[model samples]
Target: MPVLAGAEPFSHTASTEVGVLLCHGFTGSPASMRPWGRYLADLGHTVRCPRLPGHGTTWQECNRTRWTNWYDCVHTEFETLARSCESVFVFGLSMGGTLSLRLAQQLGDAVAGLALVNPSVLTLRKDARLLPVLGRVLPSVKGVGGDIAKPGVIEPAYARTPVRAAASLSRLWKLVREDLYKVTQPMLLMHSVVDHVVEPVNSRVIAEGVRSTQLTEVLLYDSYHVATLDNDAPLIFERSAEFVRSVRQVAA
Candidate 1:
């Protein structure tokens, strides 16, 4: 499957000692996060937003790939930045947040901090339990992107959700939840008040599971799931910068 034109990976090198690795959500392209990456870069912070494997392409292609492929992509990016920067912070949206949490668990103290928007950990939806069987019969379902409150904007993602790929994501959620206690890094959790895709309970579970003493939760009043591309995008960018600075101060 050919990748979408504007959905390619985005990267910016800065002179700062702190580096930020940005991860986009499942089925989403770097197009969804490039604005935030540019915002952080403008603030003189190095930024990398990698397009996950099998994304920005046909749902058929994405269905062939699993969570491991996506995880390896971001994990490699993190290792690359870790080698060059004094401190590396991770920021993600939705499933990207799940990958960030996995990295925090695996890297431990090396991960300076985390910033996530409308992250997904667990789903209360009963249908999710049937993914394995459903995936076998139905290759795809309806998509769960472009849930932004801002009009005239759309996230470049698959129109159909690949059931097999989503089942792999469910498996990842299980693993990440088990090691949530290992994620003690400072975290900024930004979630919308009303989201039709990911339930608000997901955020509650993360708050209760992680051991981060500096966990900060902010409610987005006017946005939905994709808060990074919604009306509160500016707030997400500005506060995220402040979060990086505050955590770097503590590390220094």
Candidate 2:
């Protein structure tokens, strides 16, 4: 399948012995993560952002894939980074954060640290409970993309949310929540104070559930769900870089 323009995966190799793997959100392409990857790369960190399976193409095609496929893609990328770098950190936005958490849980200390932006583990929407039933009858619904507060900045995401894929995502959320205690690595979590797509409670759940003693939480007042591309983007980039450096120092 031909990927949409600006949705191709991004990779940068650097002399730094640190590797950072970025994961984009559900229905969002690598375009949403490219700038962040570039920022890290410019700072001498090796970076990669993989296009999740069933993403970067039409939403209709996304419906044909399951959450496991997306997780597998992220796992592969992390392994590649681990092979070449002395320390590998995982960074993710939205559902990508969920995948990153799962990776940390399964791989344990293999992941140096985690930096998550508006990661979703639960949704307060009452209609979300009907996804299992609705997925059987409906192909898709309205998209949840482009919730950026910054005007004229668009996220390269699907115009519609695929029903089946979303249903599978719900299952993934349940599993991740159950294993939250297994995530003991250091973490930095950033969330928008005014996000319209994911509720703030999702981040709260993660903060309360994780066993990480080195957790840092930052609230973003200027951006929405896609804060990585919004007004507080610089904050996200700088703070994450600092977090990584701090972790490296601790390891040393």
Task: Mark the regions of model 2 whose C-alpha exceeds 4 Å error after superposition.
Answer: none
Extract clashing residue pairs from model 2. Answer: none
> Tens digit of lDDT per residue, candidate 2, span 3-53?
999999989998558999999999999999998998999999999999999
Best by TM-score: 2
Q: Rate the local accuracy (lDDT) of all candidates.
A: 0.92, 0.96
Clashes of each: 0, 0
Report the C-alpha lDDT of model 1 over 128-214, residue by residue, as the tens digit. 999999999999999987898899998988899999999999999999999999999999999999998889998999999999999
TM-scores of the candidates in the order shown: 0.98, 0.99
Find the 10 residues in a row with the least total lDDT in model 2: 9-18
Error of 1 at 35 (Å): 0.8
